[model samples]
Target: MGNRILIVDDEWNMRNLIKIYLSREAFQLNEAKDGYEAIEMADQYAFDLVVLDVMLPDIDGWEVCSTIRKTSEIPILMLTARDDVKDRVLGLNIGADDYLIKPFAPEELVARVKALLRRRKKDNREIDKLLITFNDLSIDYDSRETWVKGTRVELTPKEFDILYTVAHNPKTVFTRDILLDKIWYSEEFRDLRAVDTHVKNLREKVRKAGLSFNPVKTVWGVGYKFNRPEDQY
Candidate 1:
């Protein structure tokens, strides 16, 4: 009836303390003493979230997160010491959905967990599954998969979002400003670069798929446009 959470820590007391604190919140909680146990439990159980400690006996949280990411996008929340900002960033870069420093309040943990799950659910709801085809490249939104003439293409979430936006409405020119508003929450000009980067990355991925065709075209100083095969100059 509640969200399932796996708390992985070498210290059993720490795990138990957190479990007691979280129990009132009605989360279906589980625990693992180390990364090895975490992985084994994860492989055997379907947990909605994982709260992973950075320091583990058999394996560290970073490796655990990376290993899990190779197979699943299930949300991961890493635990790092207060002084380890680099560790926090590393966790994020390595596929952790979020991170909390040591000695964090139980209530803050609850809030962060709730916020992450809320955002993920909102994102999932916005995804409309459609099988879009242009030339040899076809995108299936339902499975979150893309293909070029039968070859699969891997895309990050942002890259996929950018491609989906433009490809959904072919031939429409979306200015950097407009795209920034559409793809990112910030209206700042600095965020415009992110849109450009995602587009660039998307194009490169398409190129890697052995397709000579580029669906997205820059509109000089104006914006970017999704060019259908027949519409390209």
Candidate 2:
């Protein structure tokens, strides 16, 4: 069977249009007309991706995305009529993987979907290297959890991704732009300060959890790098 995809939208025509376009790719498709149905289907079935529309009868797509993120790391492609940067940023910030404005080309939708799925596939390939430890800091890739001094420290999805990316490449300086491209996976939002904000939050979280050393180090005028000193090993 092909990848399972759930399309969530209230409009019958929009749902039908998406189904027609995506069915050609051999993806097993499902439909939910509202946020409640979407959330229920998402919880009940194992879907590879979700094509979500922001305007829904209940709860809204942002809530749906956050709800799903709380449990699964499923890729979400958000559809919105409003092209406001704030709206797009809100969706991305809430855990939607990618955003597409309404009236988008069928080909563009297909391309973004394929790109997200490809990225997910590539991420899955790293499952074997599940856990990495650096002194008191530890990251569990499979569980998407981080531990400091044997105590699990809560991290937002983006926070975890940023930490993992830097930690996996110790001593490698990552400019804000590089981290945005790698973690956001979309060029739509390029606010460099977002990286700094996340890193700050991640640092505080781990620090409050009893970590002694700074896990993410800042480079003056450059970017940031993992501070895995020789003693960490």
Question: Which residue pairs in model 1 clash with each other?
Answer: none
Task: Using TM-score, give the best candidate's number.
Answer: 2
lDDT of each residue in 56-109, candidate 2, tens digit only: 987899999999999999999999999899999999998999999999999999
| Per-residue alpha-carbon lDDT of candidate 1 for residues 50-163, written as tens digits (9 for 90 to 100) | 989999998899999998888878899888876667777888999999888888998998888888778777766565337788889788877878888899899997788777
TM per prediction: 0.56, 0.57
Model 2 Cα shift for residue 125 (angstroms): 0.6
Clashes of each: 0, 0
RMSD to the hidden true structure, all candidates: 11.2, 13.2
Error of 2 at 28 (Å): 0.2
Candidate 2 whole-model C-alpha lDDT, 0 to 1: 0.92
* Model 2 error, position 118 (Å): 0.4
Query: What's the lDDT for all of these models?
Result: 0.85, 0.92
Candidate 2 at 136: error in angstroms?
24
